[model samples]
Target: MSKGLKTLLAGAALLLVWGALAAYTAQMSLPSLGGGIAYDPLFVPQLLIGAGIVLAIILMVQGIRPLLAGIRIADEEPQKTGRILFVIVAVGLYFAAMPVLGFPLSSAVFLLVFAFALGYRKPVGLVATAILGPLVIWYVFTAGLEAPLPAWPSF
Candidate 1:
């Protein structure tokens, strides 16, 4: 199959899934208190899903040209599947360790491991990024947003 056809099919499938979820979300009942509407939890999700569906349709329309022309899309370095899998595993580990190590520490560790896994070789830059990135995020969430994250393990 042409790359465009594959792209179009994938977009269609994604659109279908998005539509289904949006429909389900729309069916959820809004909260009420003393006959007054109180909350609608699914509102944001429905809006985001609607936006995704629109983008998927756009992608499908763009793919039609190459699909009709039967031109295959050129593969750009298709041998990186192992690296992709490694990144996925690293993310999983990061999440699993978050509760124990706390967000700032676990995220820093994950950043370092991810950078190295992706073939980054600058030790100073890697160290700076790994340390500073998580600290910045932690400060934004905790101080700026007033959202507290898990604390480091106390022993």
Candidate 2:
């Protein structure tokens, strides 16, 4: 089998697993609150999973098209292992810092650092995205969804 085929198959297998997990999440029992405050805890998870599945399917189709046309996919440049590791470690630290630094602060810091790590320059855009993105999400969750996130640190 070609490397592309193998990769595609592996991705399909992962998508299958993700779909199963999403199915389980969809079946989760929602909490019943008085005054018809029906809250589906799995909404965000299911929505994200659905989006991932759709994107994966689109990518799979793109991969399969060239293969079906008998065109060899060009080998791309190898990714830097150090950069990948940095991102992994940074994400771990971001999660760990959330409770202590609060979601807004930690998210801003993480977004800034993560974008920088990915080689995004342009200070104004980076700073705006880093600051405003989390704030918008915070508002949506806290105000729109009625789900309160950790806005400020306890300490």
Candidate 3:
């Protein structure tokens, strides 16, 4: 099968899955106290799923032209699957360590290791990013959004 045909089929499948999930989310019960309010627990999920379904449909429509013309899209260079797997494992470990080490510490450590693994060799840059990035993110989530984040370890 042509690449366009494959793309169209994949997009259609994704659209179907997203639509079903969105429908299911829409059926979930809202909080009783918030009956007259605009807020609903499933609102965000439904919105995101709706967006995904729209995007997938667009992709499928775009693919149809090339598919009908019997044109095959050129494949891109293969990715480094091993590096991808390593990053996934590293992220998993970071999340696993978060409860014990706390978000700031674990995130900093993860950033340092991840940067090094991705070929960033500058110690100053690595150290700065490791320290500042998590702090900024924590501040934004906690202060700006009024969301609570895991605190630093007391010890």
Candidate 4:
């Protein structure tokens, strides 16, 4: 019920999901172009996801420590409501728009909006993040590894 417990549970769930995904990928025979692929998708996601699961488990354990110390951020922070609201809205919009606008567009918009909202008030920083995040992400999936991103919607 508490935030720390909730965070622990969420991290546990993420670890489980990542573990399953990594196991599934392991069971599938990869093609002959064997090498690292966090940029490539060959063994990349599996590797990164597997590591993520481990890290999440670590986080889950660490999150429980504050409960041992009897400190709760959830009960005290007035800004918590606003933070949660913004995150929920942003995530909802991203998923909703992804199928409509495609990943690059949706992701770019999401980062730009979030950065701007987070008080990255300088126009240059805001513009640079808006452009750079998507460009870098696009290049990673498409050019670095030859992965395919979804096209703009209306297909």
lDDT of 3 at 36: 48
Cα lDDT tens digits, model 3, 53-110, are 8899998988798978867876566568899999899989998888778779999999
lDDT of 1 by residue, 1-155 (tens): 55687678888998999989888877877663443323455657767898999999988987798867767786555556787888788888888899888987888888898889788999999999999998998899999999999868533
Can you give the lDDT of residue 115 in candidate 3? 94
Minimum summed lDDT over a 10-residue window in model 1 is located at: 32-41
Q: Please, what is the whole-model Cα lDDT of each candidate in the order they appear?
A: 0.82, 0.82, 0.85, 0.78
Compared with the true structure, the alpha-carbon lDDT of candidate 4 equals 0.78
User: Which of 1 and 4 is ahead in TM-score?
Assistant: 1
TM-score of each: 0.51, 0.51, 0.49, 0.48
Candidate 2 per-residue lDDT over residues 1-155, each given as its tens digit:
55566557766876897789888886788774545433556667778898878877876776687678787755566567899899889999998999888889999999998998799998999999999999999999999999988889879
Model 3 misplacement above 4 A: 1-75, 153-155
Candidate 4 C-alpha lDDT tens digits along 1-155: 56887788888888888888877887887565545454344556666876898899997987798788897767344456787899889889888888789877788788889878766789887878777888788889988999988756645
TM for candidate 2 is 0.51
Measured with C-alpha atoms, the lDDT of residue 92 in candidate 4 is 94
Candidate 2 ranges with C-alpha deviation above 4 Å? 1-77
TM-score of 4: 0.48
- After TM-score superposition, the amount by which residue 37's alpha carbon in candidate 4 deviates from its true location, in angstroms, is 44
